[model samples]
Target: MEETAGDHQACRERPAASHLSWAGDGPETRSGLALGHHRPGETPMSHHLRTLAVVGSACAISATLLSSAASAAPGSPGPARVDAAGDATALKRPAWTRLRAEHSKKCVEIPGWSKRQGVRADQWSCVKQANMQWALWLVQAPGAGGVRHHIYAIQNRNSGLCLTVDAKRNGSSVTQRQCRNKKYGDNYTKQLFWYTPDNRFFSQYAKGKCLDIAGASKRNRALTTVWKCSYAKNQRFKNIK
Candidate 1:
């Protein structure tokens, strides 16, 4: 009972009844209202209503698509991308600088022109010595909740030793120590310092303490230490490039 080739050709050639109704002969069809159903004497108000309905539907569809696109877009802000080699933000990377005491106008230096660790840091004349210059690097502290907190390590350009606190207690002397590039934990915690908007280096380990010139001394070779931050001139420092 297999159908012949001619029978198959005839079946393919025959159109379905639904297709015939869509050929401008019916009142309405699946595609839309048949053109033949619209009388020549149709009211102009009805035509305007139909046109408005189509425009409103298109507007609604466009609004929904725009809303979906906006909802699916990325929301979180991107991380700040700064060039390390450029002069964008100097504190964001390690840069050579001269630390000038606000009260004494002297630059920070290592004693006896030594680059060795355990040497006390002092303020001396603004000389062009390599030991007087520091390479400051900012390490981003952890637990930053949408706010940036930095720990700065100032290393002597001559000896490569980092400026550190002799002890973690208050009134500790600031000295040069072996550079410990740590962001957190017990190592180098006392050495980490944070710079404030008022141009003072605040000690991270010693709460409420800042890098201060001893006795507000204006004499050469005056020692630097950590004292209670009082917004005084002795506690302020300027990073001279």
Candidate 2:
């Protein structure tokens, strides 16, 4: 298909619901230390001074604890902490990968995947080509209401064009189009997709569509399009390498 700027129209907006929940050790508790009582010969002034010192130390410790808690508030995108093993287990981000169709035994490919726009994405015999690999980038969709959904842009490794839904309609053929760099006013919604826990590639723009192998053919060059998502094997794919 010929490349055209008009083929890349604005994407529709959709709300997201996924959020990263923070899991860590519970709030630290400090034990109350018993202050020693004044002895029989101890002066009243000295005992009073000792008591005051203990109270001041306790107050300082309490302030420090509060400060730490505030910094580690839930949903805060702060740096990951090291565990007891001294290993820094940072938040795991999705990586670039090649998607292999479970039933067809093919990989998603963007034919003539270049810097041009309007190239259609399809499936081909599993190969080690770079154009068949995709870089999965997570982006927040519009109208998410503060929830972080698993929206992503499947960008071609060689061409840099993102996997997009042509014409932004249901049953639209999935294709490779220009990547949206801006935050808004682009067809980002059409380009965004999410992988379900069951490994189905769901389209963010299409309300209930998923990336599917047309006709469920198990042959090479079988087309990839958007269709009503189902639990069929043709609709399932997994990232490899």
- TM-score for each predicted model, relative to the true structure: 0.58, 0.56
Cα shift from native, residue 160, model 2 (Å)? 1.0
What 10-residue stretch in candidate 2 is worst by lDDT?
A: 79-88
Give Cα-based local distance difference scores for all models: 0.68, 0.65
What candidate 1 gets wrong by more than 4 Å, as runs, is 1-93, 141-148
TM-score of 2: 0.56
Q: Distance from true position, residue 172, model 1, in Å? A: 1.1
lDDT of 2 by residue, 1-241 (tens): 3322232221112122122111332332243323344445768676666556655564456556656766767541111221110111232434558998888888899876555677677788878877898767656444565645566667676775678887555457887766654343446677767787788988877878899888888877778898888899889988898
Which candidate's TM-score is highest? 1
Q: Candidate 1 local accuracy as lDDT?
A: 0.68
Assess the local accuracy of residue 197 in candidate 2 as a C-alpha lDDT between 0 and 100: 73
Q: How far is candidate 1 from the true structure (C-alpha RMSD, Å)?
A: 18.3
Report, for all candidates in order, the number of backbone clashes.
0, 3
